[model samples]
Structures are given as C-alpha cells and as structure tokens.
Target: MARVDLNDYVYVNARVRGMRSHLLTRDFFMRLVEADGFEALHALLEQTIYRREANEAFLLNPVRPDYDQALTLNLIAAFRKILDAVGGEPRRLVATLLSRYDVQNIKSVLRGKHGDATASEITNILVPVGSLRLEQLEVLAGQREIRDVINTMHAQQIKYARPLIDAYPDFTKKDHDLAVLELALDKYFYRDAIGQLKGKGTNTEMVRQMLVGEVDMRNISTLVRIRGVRLDDGEVENLRIPGGALSADEFLHLDRLGDIVRIVSDYPDPRYRKVLQKALAEYQEVDLVAFDRELEHEMTRRGAAMSNLDVLSIGVIIGFMWQKNNEVINLRILLRGKAMDRPQAQIRSDLFFVEREEGQAA
Candidate 1:
C-alpha cells in the first residue's frame, strides 16, 4: 500500500463533492421514466453530465441504434476525468478501483470471442476507462479465439491476465463454460483489490469496507440466483469470494438455507435487513429485478453515509464513484425500458437512488 497524504486529498475531495451535486436525484429519474421515447430521454440527458457524449453519439449514429454505446463512452469519459482530478497515492488508489473496468472489458472480449462476435459488436460493450487504451482493447477484440485473447493479454503482461490464463485450460475443457472464466476474473479482482489496500494510510478502512460490502452482496446474490440450479455445494463454494464480511462456513450455511430472505433478514448485519425485507416483499410480489434495485440502493445508501462521515478521506471519492455509476445504470434502464415500451412504473421501480435523510440536499 502507498502512503496517502490526507492534506493532498483536500482538493480532490472538494472537486468530488462539487461533482456529486450534479448527480441525478430520484425525482429526475422519475421524469426520465415518464419520458415518452428515446428522443425525449436523449434530450433530457443533454441537460446532465452526459451532454457531450450524447451529442457525439447522436452525430455518429443519427438513428440512435444503440444507447449502450453512448452510455459506455460517457461512463469511460467520466472515469477518466476522475483519474485526472487527483495525483499521488490517491490517484493510484482511484486507478486501482477503476481497473475493475479493465477486468470487465477483458471479460467482455473473452465472451465476445467465444461467441465469435464481430469486432464492431464486441467494441460496443467495452468500457475503455482503465490503464488499457481503446486501441489495445480493439486489438484484443479482434482475436479469433478465446485462447488468443488470453495469450495476448499475458504476452502484454497485463495485470488481469494471470487469473484468466490460469482458468483458461479448465474453461476450455469444460465445454468453454464462460461462467468459470467469469468467476475466475471476479475472484482475482476482489483478491487483488483487497490485497492492494493492506497498508494504505487513512483511507484503507473505508475502501476495505466498501469492497467487503460489495463482495458480501455479490455472494448473496449469486447464492440466490443459483439456488434452484443443478450446481453442487462445491461449485457454489467456488463462486463465493474470500475477504468478505462472512466466513466461508457461514456463507455455506446461508446457501443451504431454504429461504434467502429470512437468512438475510436474520443476519448479524442490521444495516441491510430492512432493505432486504423490502426487496423480498417486492420479489414475492413482482420479480428479482425489483429486489436487485432495493439491495443496490441499500449498499449505495450505506456508502453515502460512510462518505459523509469521512468527507476528507477517500470515502467521499468512493461514494461519488458509486453514485456516478448508479446514475449511468439508471439512465440505461430508462433508455432500454422506454425503447421496449415497458411500463413507466416498472422502470421507475427498477432504478436505484442514493437515499437522503430529510432536509439533506443531493
């Protein structure tokens, strides 16, 4: 871990706080859901942080064929701006967090290659926000096979290539199971990110807590999704990552439980119990999408509280990053829902927002 100067974080923290002000509120998202079509949504986006990217995307694809491309570009650009806003250890820390996007891009390319997707189609899903540049990703995306993609990454000495390389043989032998490959990448990412924060000063605890919270949530969600599947306990254990709040034994026990909602509701962590109950009720009434939205909101809400308590530390930046990412996700949901003519109420229900206490501004 690198030494972080708390004083140095002052400027960046201020900048992040200012940027947080620009994040879309719940009200704004409701308005987006009320939007009649993609054109209206695009117009609404012009009034937000996506103004530039939205314009560029419209210029390139006048028919607005795929809004995901524009959204991905916008998110990448926003992350780059965040990278540029800091220096020294903070920059390195933020870059480390952003590297998850590199992992995501690599996974996308591997999957695309597995499916024999065209370069243009693969590029649409790539988010070029990490150390890897768009050109490098494009080159990798052109690989004819999954092995070639992994080999190229390894040959280039990319940090994320190791796990992919190690998991490649098994993935190939197992009928090219993409889940195996994806699990490898996810495990490696959490391990590496958590390992990097071992000795970082001041901000280490906040970042570690954030990472742990995310891992726990992901493990729970994975367990829920695979409940009725044919996977055995060993396979389920493989999907759970270490370094989360729960121990391996505890997670295994939770996995064996018949009621996921009751398991979460009765868990030691009270922070999420209420949210999980709400999500569970919605799940029973509607579907998993509603439950997912509530769970995400709980996480973001907790992150916001941590950030508020440690405004002078990396918590603020982490909180802002989460909010920014959620904004992009909510916008994508609106665009997709409107495009598909899904009910406005359903779209609005599926969106996650950073919950605010009464009298608190966004």
Candidate 2:
C-alpha cells in the first residue's frame, strides 16, 4: 500500500463533518429540557441522531438506564463506526485522541477496586473508545486487586500501567495516586506520541498549542482542586504533571501566590485565556464542578472552532472528536435532568455549549 498521506484526511474530515452535523444544537437542548422522564428522553433521542444506539440500548437495559451511560455507549459505538469507515492514518490519529479513555478506565479500575465497588459498577463507568479493549477493562475490573489490572496492561505496551504498579505500595492516598497516574499518562501520550511534532510546519503549531494549552488548564484545575481540599504544598506539587506550558515550579508558584487572576489576566493564548478566566471566576463563586465544566466547555469550543478552519492538518479531526465527546456529555445531562424531574430551565443551564459566548451561562 502507498504511504498514508494528508489526502486521506479529506475523507476522514468529510465523515467527521457529517457526524458533527448530528450533534444536538443549542436549540435541541432547549427542547430536551421539556422532556418529562427517561422514557420521554428516550423518545426524543430515538427521533434524533441517537436513534440507532437508543434502540439497541433500550432492548438491553429495557428500563431506561442512566441517560449518560446510554449516551456514552452510543457515542462510543458511533466513534468506532467512524473510525472503521476512515480506516488508515485517520484511524491512527483518532486512536491517539482516544488513548486517554484507557487511562481513565485504569483510574476507574483502581478507584473501584479501592472503594470495593462491584464489577458491574466499574464496567458501567468505563468508556471503551480507546486503544484498550472493553474486554480488557472488564477483565481488570474483575481482578481482586489493582496490581492485577496493571499487569494486564503490560501486554499492550501501555507503559502507564507501570506507574500504577509502582504507586500501589503507597496507595493509601487514593486520590493522590489517581491524579499522579492520570497526569503521568496525559504527559506520556503528548510528549511521546503527539509532542514529537514540535516543528513540522503546516498547522502543527496550532495543534500543539491546543494540546499544550489543554494540559496547562488541566494542571491549573488540579491545583485549584487540591488547594480546595486543603492539600499541603508537598502533596500538591507531587501531583503536578510537567508537560504543560507552565513548568512544575511555575504552576506551584502561581497556586501559592493566589495569582490565578493575574496569571490568566493577560494570558497570550486565547484558548487558555478564556478557560482561565472562567475557572478563576467559578472558583471564586461556586465549586470545582462548575469551574471544571466551564473550563471543559471552553476547550470544547476551541476545538470545535478549530475544526471549522480551512487548515488541512489534524485540527478538524481533533475538533470533531471533542465535539462528539461533548454530545455524549450533553445527552447524559439531559437524561439525568429528565430522570430527576428537574425543570427544563435548570437542565438547560447544565448543558455546555462549546460555541457559546463567554458571557452566556449555558
């Protein structure tokens, strides 16, 4: 076969664009808010883009499952189908993006095992859209201890399993270990796989900027959460992941100085600036969940905007993937809203709009 070329991206992007169109618009959220229960929500989804998965899941769960879980499984299937269709460099590229899912699953396995959660609970929480198979995660979840999961991962060349293995001995602080392992995995994926494209010309810089900015925001969020939880300096810095725009020292310094506002005030990067501002504001008034969702929305908006650009590199692909993920989240929120009999207004407020204006709450 001829080498994979940028030409293949055209086909992949085309497929992604079509998939993107099926994502619920802001208007759709407004309508979904009126849904009465899981059944009503299911009816709405069946008429919309989630029809295929909704139909399939309804048969399995019979009674409506949690909206988010149903939505997640559906989205994973859709992503898988798209990957299969655009099988080539397109597949490889998206695989890189989804690798984070494996990291997340591992984190879940560790948490579940530590908390004595049942196998079903862990399996339900896992999103199998990444390099790791769902069966693998299921197997790990069945293990009596976390180390067994780590051993299972060794076969896949997912070196992240090593840190989890090493950290298990001192796993008394479960949250700290999870954070450290996740940060380690995030840095490893970028530095080893994505980061090597430091100066490959054409749109690579923009892509790199987005990824690095994302890591920076994640680190900042982590710092804020740790501080909120009253973690001491030693514990906080130990949890810091180093591949972002800020050095480990700088992240700690910024956190110590109560300098979040100043740090984000004139931030040169637009993507990071918007997110930093939202995070700063939310942290002041609300809880970490609000700050996290706002920051996440900011990132998704940036990725979605990048996808629409005329650039030919992976920008569009990244944007599409981000948007798809958002779709899954949105559906989950709607389902939960319906199940709880929450008012439409309240549910709508929880939806994250990537393209939303900075001033708009939803």
Q: Which candidate is the best by TM-score?
A: 1
RMSD of 2: 4.3
Give me the runs in candidate 2 sitting further than 4 Å from their true place. Answer: 1-7, 37-39, 87-89, 155-157, 172-177, 196-199, 203-207, 227-236, 259-271, 356-362
- Quickly count the clashes in candidate 2: 0
Residue-level lDDT tens digits of model 1 in 228-272: 567677877888988787777777777777576757665656776
lDDT string, candidate 2, 43-65, tens digits: 87787877876787778778755
lDDT of each: 0.79, 0.70
Q: How much is 181 displaced in model 1, in angstroms?
A: 0.7
